[model samples]
Target chain A: MSQKPEKLIDKKGLRLDGRKPEELRSIKIEVGILPNADGSAYIQQGKNKILAGVYGPREMHPKHLARPDRTVLRCRYHMAPFSVQERKSPAPSRRDIELSKVIRESLQPAIFLEYYPRTGIDIFVEILQADGGTRCASITAASLALADAGIPMRDLVVACAAGKVDDTIVLDLMDTEDKKGGADVPVALMPNLNAITLLQMDGILTFEEFEKAVNLALKGCRKIYTMQKEALKAKYESVKEVEE
Target chain B: MPTFFERRQLVTPGDLLAEGTYVTGENTYKENNKIYASRLGLVEYEDKKINVVALRAFYIPKLGDTVIGTIVEVGFSGWTLDISSPYLAILRASEVLSRPFRPQENDLAKVLDVGDLVIAKIMAYDRAHDPRLTVGEPGLGKITRGQVVKMTPTKIPRVIGRKGSMVSMIKQETGCHIILGQNGVILITGKSLKDEQLAMTALRKIECESHTSGLTDRISQMLKKEKAKQKEEIKNESKT
Candidate 1:
């Protein structure tokens, strides 16, 4: 195995992965994959693989934590031990807990929690493989799982990450680029409402670059939103044809 | 200036449904004279009202609906039942058995202990507390025999068919007594093991092919074939 060259982007305006600066990695989504959970979904983004399961809008356990006015939303973001090249721990790490909280908050806006008052909705996202931007992919998968579970929501949330690498703004950075020390910005949005639900930035960027990255991420999110809808439609349409 | 999506059109959250002078229904919200779908589902237009019927979802409790629950805990006066909903169900001792209960002499747990399945009706419900259940009514109470099957709550309507025509057909052909819970629990009682297994298969077929048309005819054909096979087996056994 050879080390990656210092130059992250070629003079031809392409990245090492042969993608343009503004191009995103390929994404694949499937819904209703788990039989046990009320709703479940799987997503593949480039080399990242994630599975999301949703349970409840049913009872809330540890009864003390139950909210009286609206349904409590609990999210768990976990990485399988085999997800990384080096085996990861099965237990929840500090990073995992923080990610879970952010992910849960990102989704709370889209769901109509009040509709299922006093109940709880639990979302579990497992990272089977991690390339880069697993958080964004997990958020996307969790939202789809929630939809599959038939939870009422104001909108579906879509997410994408953008980064500044080699002095150029790129959409959907890969694991290699992410490790090269750059400004990575992950954004989650309610695409139809054009509202940003989650945003996190690491490294540094100029004001102009930040604005451009956000716009690029939003555009990428819209594309993801379209794909999500298509996946759902394909599932339902096939069922319809069989019925017909 | 009312707008509408075509009947049976699939829509996702934030997709516009109708605008102006239209009442929004389930899984829909209105903003600035425009109604939008609040979830992924099929659009419905009826009686000048637009609604989105969700394709899948968890079951929420409703008053007067029948349910199949397992006693999870026995309290002083009531039992906590798991009805497969997010909200637990509470069955008071008074409503559990028809006979008068003397707390000093009769223990509620002895009558209906944990892990026992009971068929009950939702007698009362409120959002803040667990739904109240009653098993004293006829055809309700502990499930002494039969197998339990679960399906999607949304598909229960299909299982029942129009006014229970489909369920009755399954019972007549398989000779199985089936009780369908609105929350998607099903109890099937058959006279023989073979008949019970056949009834379960027929129920599963409905669960799988529920979206298709002519299901009633298809189920009837499947059941008729099974009956013929059973008759042939009986004849061979008698000959021996």
Candidate 2:
């Protein structure tokens, strides 16, 4: 909102990643990447690489933690010790736990819990690189992993972040923009019906500005949803062709 | 302009949605929706409420999953195997029914040495704790002097085929007792090293080309050709 930072040199209000205020980063996704996981995916959006592995919908839920009506969604979001610029601590710190909780809540709505009553679905999302918007990346990767697992889902959950930088709202904030941006708003959307499933914003923004940011983020989410659909369709089609 | 929820939704990496759309109450929301730019994705409106679907896969270890494992540590009760899953597997002492008459010091490593390649079954997986495994049964144990090949655990079911037809075909052709680990570690051993090498090559082909149909027939023809070649070489040697 004030003077632009040196890194955010805005000739026509575009970020260093060559994206406009409402443009998102390029995303590449591959499903069933992890052999051990029931469903898994590797996703790369710009420099952010994330691997999500899904396990369960299994019977046991730990007697004390069992739910009566639907299945439980347990998620763990972790960064590999070598994922960051510098090596992170080996053990999960408090920050990781909190992030995991948020991710779990975001993914729970997409899962069909009633289908597998009294069981639990465990999703482990690992950040292989931390450029920016790790949470959004994790959500996208987790959704693809779920689809690969053949679990019944209404639609895919696509996530992306939008923030204000240099007096303009930019979609898909890169690492530098995230740190220096005025306000950061990350969103996960069910792109098909145009619904909000997960939303988090930090820093300062007026109500109008916040709504605009959400709108821009949604636009980015739609772009990502197309890519997700294409990737899954391509994978299955390729296999099916081979079978034929 | 179309509203956010009305647009043909597209999902991008790292998009977040509103609070109530995906979760319930103050902080929770639904998972997957059909709505564009909505955090929960698209939705099919019914009965004034939306139904959300999961967009990720779920890992479930079944009764006879063939897994690739490494002997991480040896314990008095059993040997620990790191199968790259949430839970590690234990090959218990009792499961190893054929123990030496008088167990000498360091006998565990002798039979199943540290860092030995093993293809075992998921005898039982306890959600409360680690999974219990058994390599002592026929066709399961510490795999020494055999080549190990890796594949996706999901593809194991396809590779084995219906009612073990695929595996049986491979075995009859190669004359090897192949142990399929639920975790995708395949162990194949033949009477001689040459036979073992041939089997390993064939199995690797299967792993890579599993998506293709009629694999059984293709592999059967390949093996028959190999067998005839071997017979011709043997005949030439006898004439010499």
lDDT of 1 at A17: 84
TM-score of each predicted structure versus truth = 0.92, 0.60
Runs of candidate 2 exceeding 4 Å displacement: A1-20, A29-135, A138-157, A164-170, A174-182, A190-197, A232-244, B1-72, B81-86, B91-126, B129-145, B181-185, B221-240
- Per-residue lDDT tens digits for candidate 2, residues B1-240, read 112232223222223333233323211134444222222222223333432222222234567665668888877656888775534678876677555433444456655657877777788864444677777556666566777776655457656888999888888887887877766667777887767777777776676566555888887788788888988998999999
- Computed on C-alpha atoms, the DockQ of candidate 1 is 0.62
**Model 2, span A1-244: residue lDDT tens:** 2344686846866677677677777888887778887788999999989999987665445746757666778889999998887799968899899889878777777666665555667899988888989999899889888767655555578888898887788889887888887999999987644668899998899898899999989888888888887776565456446656
Steric clashes per prediction: 3, 84
- Model 1 / residue B5 / CA error / Å: 3.7
User: lDDT of all predictions, in order shown?
Assistant: 0.88, 0.70
TM-score of chain A of each: 0.97, 0.92
